[model samples]
Target: MLPVGAGAIGTQARTADSPVMRMLDELNHPATAAHILAERTMLHMLRGHCNSPIAGYADTTPDGRMSLFGMVFKRDGSAFVRSHAWGDPSDPATLGSRVAADLLHQGAMKLIDATRK
Candidate 1:
């Protein structure tokens, strides 16, 4: 299995409007686009770069609710904070931001800081 933060880099590249995003757009995958957008929004809100020990995932239910899960960990993997939030799917950013806020409230930044060194 991949490490906790493995899914983050690809999303960061896509967020940079790289060729991968172009390919996904050309493939006409709106759902995929939306999902990635929400997940990336969480990463952005948390100030998480690909190299950070931070991981996030977001998804929307068929009924239009968006849910986001985020985690931050120390470099040694000795501690971590995780949080989740849900909201209207159409406003994915709100859901993502809320989850990030929750993580912050749980002291995620401390873990992130520990990882940076």
Candidate 2:
């Protein structure tokens, strides 16, 4: 584990050059990879086939208390969570504002992924 938190650092930002818009981008890790892992973990655990828990995380603050989970689930109702840890202790508003926005982006991706099938 990367301490209690190290995922979140720096304020969230937007760049016009962004080719794709995913809030998970608020952190540096690839959301797709993290999501896939979460899905696999969730499915395996739920189905009793999991080798181990697949917990991945990113910093939302730097050492904050709270994690943004990328728990992945499919249209079939199988899923897992990808988590982002907070960088520091923060108010719910700060956590919700920054984290939620990015998660919303991630949720949209999940929908699209479901639709692709």
Candidate 3:
């Protein structure tokens, strides 16, 4: 099997104003929300889909910073590119975008595109 890797599971909600959305937001934990936002932002930036050979995870540090890790792999696991970074929890999207840029710079798209064939 491929080496063990990080993963995330999340639920989605409508961004439009609604009672349910407000209630969910009120119930959400700040750190958990930050982590999810960062991970999803990275995946969106990479155009990753459910079947894609992509992985992303985000978590909070002890000092309240957010840490993000992302990876994209070849279909056969023969090659891959990964990026990791730390950023302010208040702007997790920026951190995600930064890591996505790093992976793209490392030629992650070539590996990702090969999987489509």
Winning model by TM-score: 3
Error of 2 at 90 (Å): 3.4
Rank by lDDT, highest first: 3, 1, 2
Cα lDDT of model 1 by residue, 1-117, tens digit: 122323432423447877877775565655545556766676777777656788777667677777677788877788888887778767776777888888889888777666567
lDDT of 1: 0.69
Badly placed stretches (over 4 Å) of model 3 are 1-23
TM-score, ranked from best to worst: 3, 1, 2
lDDT score, candidate 3, position 52: 74
Clashing pairs in 3: none
Candidate 3 per-residue lDDT, tens place, 11-103, comes to 468878587788776766777777777877877777776567888778788998888888889888888899999999999889989998998
The candidate maximizing lDDT is 3
Better of 2 and 3 by TM-score: 3
What is the lDDT of every predicted structure here?
A: 0.69, 0.38, 0.78
Clashes of each: 0, 19, 0
Q: Estimate each model's TM-score.
A: 0.72, 0.28, 0.79
